[model samples]
Structures are given as structure tokens and as C-alpha cells.
Target: MVSSLQKSMINLTQVLRLREHQKSFKELEKLGAIDVYYLEAIYQLKEPTIGTISKLLGQSTPNTNYHIKKLVNLKLIEKRIDDVDRRVTHLTVTSRYSELINSDEDFWTRTQERLESEIAATDLAIFQRVLRQTIEIISEESREDTISD
Candidate 1:
């Protein structure tokens, strides 16, 4: 029999992945995995260069460039050369991406209300903390795996 802990972990991933696929990532379904990472990092950095984006996402220059080209072709991101530095190219997402990343557009509002109503008030904070810690642990593991490779 599967342990309750294992089932909970599976459920967590299922719910999160379902939400991402159904909403936030629907328009982005055509993008590659690395492309998604670069897009998010670029969005956060406002406008960053190829090297900066590669470093931020812990990916190689050539690999990042490949995804950048794909995103550019899709018209989801824009690339422009710096006037002062002819070799420096900076990237920024188009307006569509800006709209996609808006938190208000997410199902989180309704999900939160449903969760609060279904779950006991006393356990909410504890659940939030545990969820955050779980994410951190997974992130740390990913970093460690990347470093090892």
C-alpha cells in the first residue's frame, strides 16, 4: 500500500501541475522547458542580456540562445542591441507575457477562499509554512543536482 505521505506528495504535484497547465502555462505550452525559465527570469529582471539570463537560469550560453531564438520567433520576447555597446543584446517580453504573469488573473483567489473554507483556520498558517519549506527543499535539491552535473 502507498503511504499517506507518498500520496500527499503525489497529490501536491498533481494539483500544482494541473493548475499550471490549465491556466498560467496554457499559452506557454509551445515553449521549451529552458525557454520557460528564461522567460520568467527575463520578466523578473525587466531587461537582461543573454549572458545575464544564462547565468541567472544556470544554463549555458548556446542553450539559452537556442530558446531565445524560439521565443523571439513566437513574438513573445523582444531583443534589442545596446546603442553604446554594439555586442550587447538585451531581452524583454512582449505585452502578452505581462498580462499572463498578472497574479490577479490566476485562480489563486478562488482557490484560497475554497481552501480557507474547507480547512481549519488553526492549521492554515502551519500549512503555509510547510508548503514554503517543501518548495525550498526542492529548490535546494535542484541546485545541488545542477552543481553536481
Candidate 2:
């Protein structure tokens, strides 16, 4: 029999719900049309300036501004000028955008509650620990790859 962990990996790889439905997938698709790199830069850069974001995206300032304008129009992100350095403008995701990113909170909670009903808490804890360690290991490997590259 396949282990729970193996089943989980299979489920994640096998399911393509996000790609199958247009209406259901609209938000993600709209954001993706702007390029996944913009979202990644917004997440990883921590309120970086447009120039910084442009550099991170390997795009010209005009191109970065164009994407940023799209993000702003979509209400996915907001911009603020620095008080000390007016030339420095910072970009940040709106709280609503964060909520959109975390849209599966209710689904996960209901799934966990059902899971708890079917399994002992100790077993659940072990499963959670394993998942956490897996995430950490993947993160470490990614960092090592980045550093080596």
C-alpha cells in the first residue's frame, strides 16, 4: 500500500484543478498573465523600489512600471513614496490580495477537522511534522542551489 506521504505527493501532482476551470481560475490567471516573476519579486523583495523590482525582474524600468500599473489596476498591489527619499517608491500587495493568496484557509481547516475525526491526534502530529521537515529540506536544497549557482 502507498504511504500517506506518497499518496499526498501523488495527489498534489495528479490534481490540476487550477488549470481546468476558467472562471474558478480567473484570479490566478489574471495575475499570471502579468508574469509569475512579478508576484515572486513582490514576495521576496520586501517592499522593493520600482528600480529594484525592475532589476530583480531583469526588465527595464518602463517595463516594470507597466507591470506595476497592471498590478495596481487589478488592486493586487499598492505603492507608496518614501518620506525621506521621494524618488524611492515602494510596492506592496494589498491585504485583499493577501487574502486572495490565502483563499484556501477555510478549505484546509475543514479538511483538517475531518482528518482529525478519522485519525488520532498523535498520528496527525507525526504527519504534520513530516510535512514540515519535507518543506524545510526542500527550502534548504533550494538555498544551496541558489548559492552554488
Candidate 3:
């Protein structure tokens, strides 16, 4: 049985995640529909592959590839050939876009202020720890189910 504190923490994280998603969606809408998903995917992922992105976004490889090609054409992301394997390409955010996205001082400052005001450091740390553990547990369960099937 989950404690009330744990339940509240889960709800708070869900609300925060939803709010961020809404904010990101608004920002993407300002860019363009295709650009919105591309930017959102890039922002969420560390070094996501085409297949991983396709799975996450509920898009087919062909569709994802088409958008990725357009993003490449627009110079938002750079696709580099992996040094270890010439046939393997890795997608990375371009320096130009990194500057544009990272240099949005107003957004960053406002977000920082809101977080500082709303979330305590200790609570935030606990929330992050629990979230990570929950993700690992769920993933392990999924793998077990897959093996059983």
C-alpha cells in the first residue's frame, strides 16, 4: 500500500510534467506543427535514435524520417556519421539551435523562479529519486512480461 505522501508526490510530478508538456506544446505551436514535434522530441531526448523517436512519438519510420530530413534541411539538427561505424549516423542538436534554445533568458529565468518558489529542494530530490525508481521498476516488469509471452 502506498502512503499518502507517496501518492501526493506522484500527483505533483504528474501535474508538473503535464504543465511542462503544455508549455512545450505552446512553444512548438509557435514554431510550426512539424517543427513542434521535432523540437519536443529533441528537447526530451538525450541522444535518441530514429527508431526510438518513432516509437516514442507513435510515428512510422518513414514519417519520422521525412520530418527528420526536413529538420536536417532546416539546419536545426545535424546528422553525423559515427566514427566507429561509417554506416551509422547520429543525430545531434546543432550549435546554432542550442544557442537559440538555451539563450532564451526570459523563459529560463521564469522557470527557475517558479521552481524555486514552488518546490522545496529536499522534496524535489525525493521526487526525482522516486520517479527514477518507478521507471526502473516498470521497465523491469515490462521486460519480464515480454519474456513470459
Choose the strongest candidate by TM-score.
1
lDDT tens per residue, model 1, 14-95: 8876766667557787976677778876775667888877766777888888899999998889999998999999999998
Worst lDDT window (10 residues) for model 3? 23-32
The lDDT of each candidate is 0.80, 0.73, 0.68
Regions more than 4 Å wrong, model 1:
1-3, 24-26, 32-34, 37-61, 72-98, 103-106
Residues 20-108, model 2: lDDT tens digits:
33235466567554455686567655687787667655688888888899888888789999989988899888886787756767776
Give the least accurate 10-residue stretch of model 1, judged by summed lDDT. Answer: 140-149
Cα-lDDT of candidate 1: 0.80
On residues 35-65, what C-alpha lDDT tens digit does candidate 3 reach at each position?
A: 5566656654645677666666667879988
> Model 2 compared with the native: what TM-score?
0.57
Clashing pairs in 2: none
What's the best-to-worst order under TM-score? Answer: 1, 2, 3
> Where in model 2 is the C-alpha error above 4 Å?
1-24, 110-149
TM-score (C-alpha, index-matched) for candidate 1: 0.59
lDDT rank order: 1, 2, 3
